[model samples]
Target: MRPRKLILCVEANEQVLSVRKFLLETRGYRVVGCASAAEAIEYLQGALPGSIDLLMSDLQLPQMDGNELVRRAKQLLPGLPALILSNTVTGYDRAAAADAFLPKGACTPAEILDRIRILVARKRGPKKQMPTAEMMPHEMAVAG
Candidate 1:
Protein backbone atom coordinates (compact mmCIF):
# COMPACT_ATOMS: atom_id res chain seq x y z
CA MET A 1 0.00 0.00 0.00
CA ARG A 2 1.17 3.51 -0.72
CA PRO A 3 1.94 5.58 2.33
CA ARG A 4 -0.08 8.69 2.95
CA LYS A 5 1.68 11.93 2.00
CA LEU A 6 2.09 14.79 4.47
CA ILE A 7 1.17 18.33 3.47
CA LEU A 8 2.01 21.37 5.54
CA CYS A 9 -0.89 23.74 4.89
CA VAL A 10 -0.19 27.33 5.83
CA GLU A 11 -3.00 29.84 5.74
CA ALA A 12 -3.55 32.95 7.84
CA ASN A 13 -7.32 32.64 8.16
CA GLU A 14 -8.66 30.17 10.69
CA GLN A 15 -11.73 29.44 8.57
CA VAL A 16 -9.69 28.74 5.47
CA LEU A 17 -7.42 26.48 7.45
CA SER A 18 -10.37 24.42 8.64
CA VAL A 19 -11.65 23.89 5.11
CA ARG A 20 -8.26 23.06 3.67
CA LYS A 21 -7.45 20.70 6.53
CA PHE A 22 -10.72 18.88 6.01
CA LEU A 23 -10.20 18.58 2.27
CA LEU A 24 -6.65 17.33 2.62
CA GLU A 25 -7.55 14.84 5.33
CA THR A 26 -10.51 13.55 3.36
CA ARG A 27 -8.13 12.90 0.48
CA GLY A 28 -5.92 10.85 2.86
CA TYR A 29 -3.05 13.28 3.27
CA ARG A 30 -1.73 13.78 6.77
CA VAL A 31 -2.06 17.53 7.07
CA VAL A 32 -0.36 19.90 9.47
CA GLY A 33 -2.24 23.18 9.42
CA CYS A 34 -0.60 26.43 10.43
CA ALA A 35 -1.84 30.01 10.60
CA SER A 36 1.46 31.66 9.78
CA ALA A 37 4.94 31.05 8.48
CA ALA A 38 6.28 31.29 12.00
CA GLU A 39 3.86 28.62 13.14
CA ALA A 40 4.81 26.39 10.21
CA ILE A 41 8.52 26.87 10.88
CA GLU A 42 7.97 25.94 14.50
CA TYR A 43 6.23 22.77 13.42
CA LEU A 44 9.05 22.00 11.00
CA GLN A 45 11.60 22.50 13.74
CA GLY A 46 9.75 19.96 15.84
CA ALA A 47 9.50 17.41 13.06
CA LEU A 48 12.08 15.31 11.25
CA PRO A 49 13.30 16.15 7.78
CA GLY A 50 11.10 14.62 5.05
CA SER A 51 8.28 14.31 7.56
CA ILE A 52 6.40 16.92 5.57
CA ASP A 53 6.29 16.05 1.91
CA LEU A 54 4.80 19.22 0.51
CA LEU A 55 4.33 22.84 1.51
CA MET A 56 0.96 24.36 0.63
CA SER A 57 0.66 28.06 1.37
CA ASP A 58 -1.71 30.94 0.69
CA LEU A 59 -0.39 34.00 -1.11
CA GLN A 60 -2.09 36.46 1.22
CA LEU A 61 -0.64 35.69 4.59
CA PRO A 62 -0.94 38.97 6.58
CA GLN A 63 2.69 39.40 7.67
CA MET A 64 5.28 37.46 5.75
CA ASP A 65 4.33 37.02 2.09
CA GLY A 66 3.88 33.56 0.65
CA ASN A 67 6.83 33.80 -1.75
CA GLU A 68 9.21 34.47 1.11
CA LEU A 69 7.47 31.76 3.06
CA VAL A 70 8.04 29.29 0.22
CA ARG A 71 11.74 30.16 0.14
CA ARG A 72 12.00 29.67 3.89
CA ALA A 73 10.03 26.44 3.83
CA LYS A 74 12.22 25.11 1.01
CA GLN A 75 15.28 26.05 3.03
CA LEU A 76 13.99 24.02 5.95
CA LEU A 77 13.06 21.03 3.79
CA PRO A 78 15.17 21.05 0.70
CA GLY A 79 13.39 19.82 -2.47
CA LEU A 80 10.02 19.93 -0.70
CA PRO A 81 7.40 20.44 -3.43
CA ALA A 82 5.37 23.63 -3.06
CA LEU A 83 1.85 24.57 -4.10
CA ILE A 84 0.89 28.21 -3.96
CA LEU A 85 -2.81 29.10 -3.58
CA SER A 86 -4.23 32.46 -4.52
CA ASN A 87 -7.32 34.21 -5.88
CA THR A 88 -5.19 36.24 -8.26
CA VAL A 89 -2.58 33.74 -9.23
CA THR A 90 -0.91 36.11 -11.70
CA GLY A 91 -0.12 38.46 -8.85
CA TYR A 92 2.27 35.89 -7.48
CA ASP A 93 5.74 35.57 -8.87
CA ARG A 94 5.42 32.10 -10.38
CA ALA A 95 9.22 31.88 -10.32
CA ALA A 96 9.19 32.32 -6.55
CA ALA A 97 10.17 28.77 -5.65
CA ALA A 98 6.75 27.16 -6.10
CA ASP A 99 6.40 23.93 -8.00
CA ALA A 100 2.75 24.49 -8.83
CA PHE A 101 0.21 27.29 -8.56
CA LEU A 102 -3.48 26.78 -7.86
CA PRO A 103 -5.99 29.53 -8.28
CA LYS A 104 -8.13 29.40 -5.15
CA GLY A 105 -11.73 28.27 -5.68
CA ALA A 106 -11.00 27.64 -9.35
CA CYS A 107 -10.46 23.89 -9.17
CA THR A 108 -12.84 21.08 -8.35
CA PRO A 109 -12.03 18.58 -5.64
CA ALA A 110 -11.05 15.96 -8.19
CA GLU A 111 -8.73 18.36 -9.96
CA ILE A 112 -7.13 19.36 -6.70
CA LEU A 113 -6.63 15.76 -5.68
CA ASP A 114 -5.09 14.95 -9.05
CA ARG A 115 -2.70 17.86 -8.70
CA ILE A 116 -1.72 16.89 -5.17
CA ARG A 117 -1.16 13.32 -6.25
CA ILE A 118 1.10 14.36 -9.08
CA LEU A 119 3.10 16.80 -6.98
CA VAL A 120 3.49 14.45 -4.05
CA ALA A 121 4.51 11.52 -6.23
CA ARG A 122 6.97 13.62 -8.19
CA LYS A 123 8.53 14.87 -4.98
CA ARG A 124 8.41 11.68 -2.95
CA GLY A 125 8.60 8.68 -5.26
CA PRO A 126 8.94 7.49 -8.82
CA LYS A 127 7.04 9.43 -11.44
CA LYS A 128 3.55 8.16 -12.08
CA GLN A 129 1.76 8.42 -15.40
CA MET A 130 -0.07 11.73 -15.38
CA PRO A 131 -3.70 11.89 -16.33
CA THR A 132 -4.03 12.73 -20.01
CA ALA A 133 -6.16 15.78 -19.25
CA GLU A 134 -3.27 17.16 -17.23
CA MET A 135 -0.78 16.84 -20.05
CA MET A 136 0.64 19.99 -21.52
CA PRO A 137 0.20 20.51 -25.26
CA HIS A 138 3.88 19.87 -25.85
CA GLU A 139 3.79 16.74 -23.75
CA MET A 140 0.75 15.46 -25.61
CA ALA A 141 2.38 16.11 -28.94
CA VAL A 142 5.51 14.30 -27.88
CA ALA A 143 3.48 11.34 -26.67
CA GLY A 144 1.62 11.17 -29.94
Candidate 2:
Protein backbone atom coordinates (compact mmCIF):
# COMPACT_ATOMS: atom_id res chain seq x y z
CA MET A 1 0.00 0.00 0.00
CA ARG A 2 1.06 3.56 -0.70
CA PRO A 3 2.13 5.62 2.29
CA ARG A 4 -0.38 8.18 3.52
CA LYS A 5 0.42 11.72 2.38
CA LEU A 6 -1.16 14.69 4.07
CA ILE A 7 -0.15 18.33 3.59
CA LEU A 8 -1.77 21.78 3.70
CA CYS A 9 -0.43 24.39 1.28
CA VAL A 10 -1.67 27.98 1.50
CA GLU A 11 -0.56 30.51 -1.05
CA ALA A 12 -2.33 33.47 -2.64
CA ASN A 13 -0.58 33.41 -5.95
CA GLU A 14 -1.69 30.97 -8.61
CA GLN A 15 1.75 30.53 -10.13
CA VAL A 16 3.33 29.78 -6.79
CA LEU A 17 0.63 27.28 -6.06
CA SER A 18 1.24 25.58 -9.37
CA VAL A 19 4.96 25.33 -8.71
CA ARG A 20 4.40 24.10 -5.19
CA LYS A 21 1.95 21.51 -6.44
CA PHE A 22 4.50 20.31 -8.94
CA LEU A 23 7.25 20.13 -6.34
CA LEU A 24 5.13 18.20 -3.88
CA GLU A 25 3.69 15.82 -6.49
CA THR A 26 7.20 15.12 -7.74
CA ARG A 27 8.17 14.12 -4.23
CA GLY A 28 5.13 11.78 -4.02
CA TYR A 29 3.22 13.85 -1.46
CA ARG A 30 -0.53 14.40 -1.58
CA VAL A 31 -0.83 18.17 -1.36
CA VAL A 32 -3.95 20.10 -0.47
CA GLY A 33 -3.61 23.57 -1.89
CA CYS A 34 -5.62 26.51 -0.65
CA ALA A 35 -5.58 30.13 -1.82
CA SER A 36 -6.23 31.76 1.52
CA ALA A 37 -6.16 31.20 5.27
CA ALA A 38 -9.93 30.90 5.42
CA GLU A 39 -9.79 28.14 2.88
CA ALA A 40 -7.14 26.36 4.92
CA ILE A 41 -9.26 26.58 8.04
CA GLU A 42 -12.22 25.17 6.17
CA TYR A 43 -10.16 22.29 4.84
CA LEU A 44 -8.73 21.48 8.26
CA GLN A 45 -12.19 21.53 9.79
CA GLY A 46 -13.17 18.62 7.56
CA ALA A 47 -9.96 16.61 7.84
CA LEU A 48 -9.27 14.18 10.64
CA PRO A 49 -7.00 15.22 13.47
CA GLY A 50 -3.31 14.43 12.94
CA SER A 51 -4.04 13.87 9.27
CA ILE A 52 -2.00 16.80 8.13
CA ASP A 53 1.69 15.96 8.16
CA LEU A 54 2.87 19.47 7.28
CA LEU A 55 1.62 23.00 6.65
CA MET A 56 3.45 24.96 3.95
CA SER A 57 2.22 28.53 3.88
CA ASP A 58 3.12 31.85 2.36
CA LEU A 59 3.76 34.59 4.92
CA GLN A 60 1.43 37.06 3.20
CA LEU A 61 -2.17 36.13 2.39
CA PRO A 62 -5.55 37.72 2.05
CA GLN A 63 -8.34 37.68 4.71
CA MET A 64 -6.02 35.95 7.21
CA ASP A 65 -2.23 35.89 7.19
CA GLY A 66 0.18 32.97 7.32
CA ASN A 67 1.30 33.62 10.90
CA GLU A 68 -2.27 33.58 12.07
CA LEU A 69 -2.92 30.41 10.09
CA VAL A 70 0.11 28.76 11.69
CA ARG A 71 -1.06 29.87 15.12
CA ARG A 72 -4.57 28.52 14.62
CA ALA A 73 -3.51 25.33 12.85
CA LYS A 74 -1.17 24.51 15.73
CA GLN A 75 -4.01 24.96 18.17
CA LEU A 76 -5.95 22.37 16.18
CA LEU A 77 -3.02 20.07 15.49
CA PRO A 78 -0.38 20.50 18.11
CA GLY A 79 3.00 19.16 16.95
CA LEU A 80 1.97 19.84 13.34
CA PRO A 81 5.05 20.76 11.32
CA ALA A 82 5.06 24.17 9.58
CA LEU A 83 7.29 25.79 6.99
CA ILE A 84 7.16 29.38 5.79
CA LEU A 85 7.73 30.39 2.18
CA SER A 86 8.01 34.14 1.85
CA ASN A 87 10.03 36.82 0.17
CA THR A 88 9.81 39.11 3.21
CA VAL A 89 10.87 37.03 6.16
CA THR A 90 12.37 38.71 9.25
CA GLY A 91 14.12 37.59 12.42
CA TYR A 92 10.78 37.79 14.22
CA ASP A 93 9.47 35.44 11.57
CA ARG A 94 11.55 32.68 13.10
CA ALA A 95 9.17 31.25 15.68
CA ALA A 96 8.45 27.94 17.36
CA ALA A 97 5.50 27.52 15.02
CA ALA A 98 7.56 27.42 11.86
CA ASP A 99 10.02 24.55 11.76
CA ALA A 100 11.76 25.91 8.63
CA PHE A 101 11.80 29.11 6.60
CA LEU A 102 12.34 29.21 2.85
CA PRO A 103 13.32 32.53 1.34
CA LYS A 104 10.93 33.01 -1.56
CA GLY A 105 13.21 35.00 -3.87
CA ALA A 106 16.49 33.33 -3.00
CA CYS A 107 15.70 29.64 -2.83
CA THR A 108 15.61 27.34 -5.83
CA PRO A 109 13.08 24.55 -6.15
CA ALA A 110 15.74 22.00 -5.16
CA GLU A 111 16.54 23.93 -1.98
CA ILE A 112 12.89 24.10 -1.00
CA LEU A 113 12.47 20.38 -1.59
CA ASP A 114 15.56 19.64 0.48
CA ARG A 115 14.29 21.76 3.33
CA ILE A 116 10.96 19.93 3.16
CA ARG A 117 12.79 16.63 3.42
CA ILE A 118 14.70 17.83 6.46
CA LEU A 119 11.56 19.14 8.14
CA VAL A 120 9.70 15.88 7.40
CA ALA A 121 12.59 13.93 8.87
CA ARG A 122 12.39 16.03 12.00
CA LYS A 123 8.65 15.36 12.31
CA ARG A 124 8.99 11.59 11.78
CA GLY A 125 11.73 11.30 14.40
CA PRO A 126 10.95 10.74 18.08
CA LYS A 127 9.23 13.60 19.83
CA LYS A 128 11.44 15.83 21.99
CA GLN A 129 10.55 15.97 25.66
CA MET A 130 11.72 19.16 27.28
CA PRO A 131 13.20 18.75 30.75
CA THR A 132 11.63 21.09 33.25
CA ALA A 133 14.02 23.02 35.50
CA GLU A 134 12.30 21.75 38.64
CA MET A 135 12.63 18.18 37.38
CA MET A 136 16.38 18.43 36.95
CA PRO A 137 18.53 18.91 40.05
CA HIS A 138 21.28 20.74 38.17
CA GLU A 139 18.77 22.97 36.43
CA MET A 140 16.92 23.69 39.66
CA ALA A 141 20.17 24.53 41.43
CA VAL A 142 21.21 26.76 38.58
CA ALA A 143 17.89 28.60 38.70
CA GLY A 144 18.03 28.88 42.46
Q: What range of 10 consecutive residues in model 2 has the weakest lDDT sum? A: 128-137
- Candidate 2 displacement at residue 31 in angstroms: 0.7
Candidate 2 off by > 4 Å: 89-96, 127-144
Please give the clash total of every predicted structure, in order: 0, 0
Please state every model's RMSD to the true fold in angstroms: 6.5, 11.0
- TM-score list, all predictions: 0.80, 0.79
Q: Which lDDT value does model 1 have at 12?
A: 94
Runs with alpha carbons beyond 4 Å of true place in candidate 1: 127-144
Model 1 clashes, total count = 0
State candidate 1's TM-score.
0.80
lDDT of 1 at 10: 93
- Which candidate gets the maximum lDDT versus the true structure? 1
lDDT of each: 0.78, 0.76
Task: Return the clash pairs for model 2, or none.
Answer: none
